[model samples]
Target: MSSPAIAVENLNFSWQPDKKILSHCNLAVPQGEFWMLLGTNGSGKSTLLRILAGLLTADSGTVELIQPVGFVFQNPDHQLVMPTVGADVAFGLVSERLPTPIIQQRVAEALGAVGLSNLARRPIYALSGGQKQRVAIAGAIARHCEVLLLDEPTALLDGDTQLDLVKQVQHLVKSRGMTALWVTHRLDELDFCDGAFLLENGRVVDQGDPQILKHRLQTTTV
Candidate 1:
């Protein structure tokens, strides 16, 4: 198998001494594949994703992930800063200091990949929840991020839009050869992933085929 694009070894985290969020958690995502993180509320799924994105520090553990990593929060409103779709996508590339031409090319390509090429100039408020998520993804694509960490990205969408967004991410990961780790509670979304990991009590108790995990989740009470 390819070397892991995202890996955590003996990860441990806690908000206070009385409780542990993640306990000796260990998991890995293979290079260029899309994987899902499954867990109930407070399962430390989001916490783990945050640590992988360097947004949070683990109390004890080793996190080795490919860079530059792109993080997509649960709400696009929290990350999309520009007024327009294209501008927002390009905004992420500003830090790289690339030439304007390069930025335009990237923005065009990223938006196109997400099927938002025609909405480049459209106001962010006019877009649907799914579109907003796509625009957020375009931002990462524009930056050419090697690894994508998504924390419940489809949580705010309807059933159709939720599945659509997950499908879009699956396509992006396979087509672009980018590694992605998505945190989701929807079992239907598992059908679109290459694999999945089940996080329980901040520890990974299962990891493997998406269908199997989906089945397990369906039959068990998280």
Candidate 2:
């Protein structure tokens, strides 16, 4: 069997010595699967994503990642820096000193994967929220990252756009056979995920099918 895409054991983290943001957290995501990290605000969802993406280090324990990760922040504006869609997507590769032809090919392929091939030259400021989000995703794909980490990616969009963006991302991830760790509070999004983990107070309290977990949450709330 293939190795898990992400593995965490006895993970612990804290911003301050007296307060913990995550405690004894453990998780494993198999390659080519989509999983949701579900939790309320301050539940350490974003913190977990940061650790997996190597943006933050755990104070203790282990994090084993089999492949490089690409992070998509909740705000597209925060990830985008170039004026045009194509330029932004190529920014990361340019720093690698890759041949011009290779960089151009990668940029084209990434934009095509996100269904933004026609807007490659469009100005970023003129794009809609959904379009901007797609641009951000294209940048990640250009990097050829094996794992995608998303933190509340749809939080800033309208309801319709949020669903559409999620569907688009789902299709892209499956087609590329990439592992995904999506952090979301919207329960409806869980229907499309292969598995889910529920976090509360910085620890994982449950793990299983999305439907089963949703039912559990609903029954407990009533």
Candidate 3:
């Protein structure tokens, strides 16, 4: 049997001892699938993404990630830490104790893939928000993760940058066969993916094609 890219079953979690946030969640993501996780605010989208990324522990459920996973957080500041764009992109690999030459090659390749080669030596803090987010993406890509989790990636981006990011995400899914789980409140972002899930109150209320889901979301909002 082919291993699922990610699987969650009867998952439950809570920040506080008495207050439960997620309740009896079950999901299965297959290899190379592009999935969009949609929800309203406070719907546990970010929390679920964190759980899949191995950052948060579930209270009492099975959460399995079959391969190395990369995460681009909602906040670019949280991901970009090094002095220069190149350095920041290389930070994760360096921590893994990769050889210096390999690290250098990976860093250059990652930056070039993100169209940030010229900005390799540029200070990370000086770049525009969109550029900083791209650097974060490059850093994640450098990890060569089989699964990529993005939490509200476009919330802080302008329209042009948001569209660009979606295109890049599509490219990654096609070329790398990387499974992506994107959590976002914006319905506009769902059009790029093949399937989407609507999450509300910590539960998956609907799941289907992007166009159908988009229409449902609009109707509910109206």
Candidate 4:
């Protein structure tokens, strides 16, 4: 059988020597699968994603991943650097010194994937929150990463926009056969995930189908 897209064994992390963030955390995502990470505020969800993305080294434990992972931060502004949408999408390819024709093609395909083809030339500042988020996703798609990691990607959007964006992301993940690990606190968004894991005080306490997990969370909460 194929190896898992991501695997973490006995992971541990802390900001300072005394304050622990994650403790013996373990997770596994199969290739081409999408999983939702559900946790309360300050539960180390973002920290875990950063670790998986190679942004932060864990204090202890192992994190094995398929190479070429794409990370989309909670705030689109953090991922977007170029002025125009198309330019930002092609930024990574440009850094690789890819031929101009290939870069243009990739940028176009990425933008189209995120439904931003028409706004390719639009200035970053002029786009709405949802549009900006799409631009960030397009940049990752342009890189053709094998896995995508998203951290609270819809925290800033309205209800309708959040739903729409999640649907688009879900479509992209399935169509591209890419693994996605999405961190979200919004219970309604769980429906879009193929599986779900719950984190509490930095440990994965429960996991299973999204609906079942949601039910457990609701019934057990005080």
Q: What are the runs in model 1 whose C-alpha is more than 4 Å off?
A: none
lDDT against the true structure, per candidate, is 0.94, 0.91, 0.85, 0.92
Per-residue accuracy of model 4 over 127-191 as CA lDDT, tens digit each: 99999999988888999888999999999999999999899989987999989999999989998
Expressed as tens digits, the lDDT of each residue in 84-179 for candidate 2 is 999999997876899999999999999999999999889999999989988988888999988888899999999999999888878877899988
List ranges where model 2 is wrong by over 4 Å: none
TM for every model, in the order presented, reads 0.97, 0.97, 0.94, 0.97
After TM-score superposition, the amount by which residue 113's alpha carbon in candidate 3 deviates from its true location, in angstroms, is: 1.9
Task: Kindly list the per-residue Cα lDDT of model 1 for residues 14-123, writing each as its tens digit.
Answer: 99998999999999999999999999999999999999999999999999998899999999999989999999999998888999999999999999999999999999
The TM-score that candidate 3 achieves is: 0.94
Please give the distance, in angstroms, between residue 111's alpha carbon in candidate 3 and its true position after superposition.
Answer: 1.4
Ranked by lDDT, the better of candidates 1 and 2 is 1
Candidate with the greatest lDDT versus the true structure: 1
lDDT (Cα) of model 1: 0.94
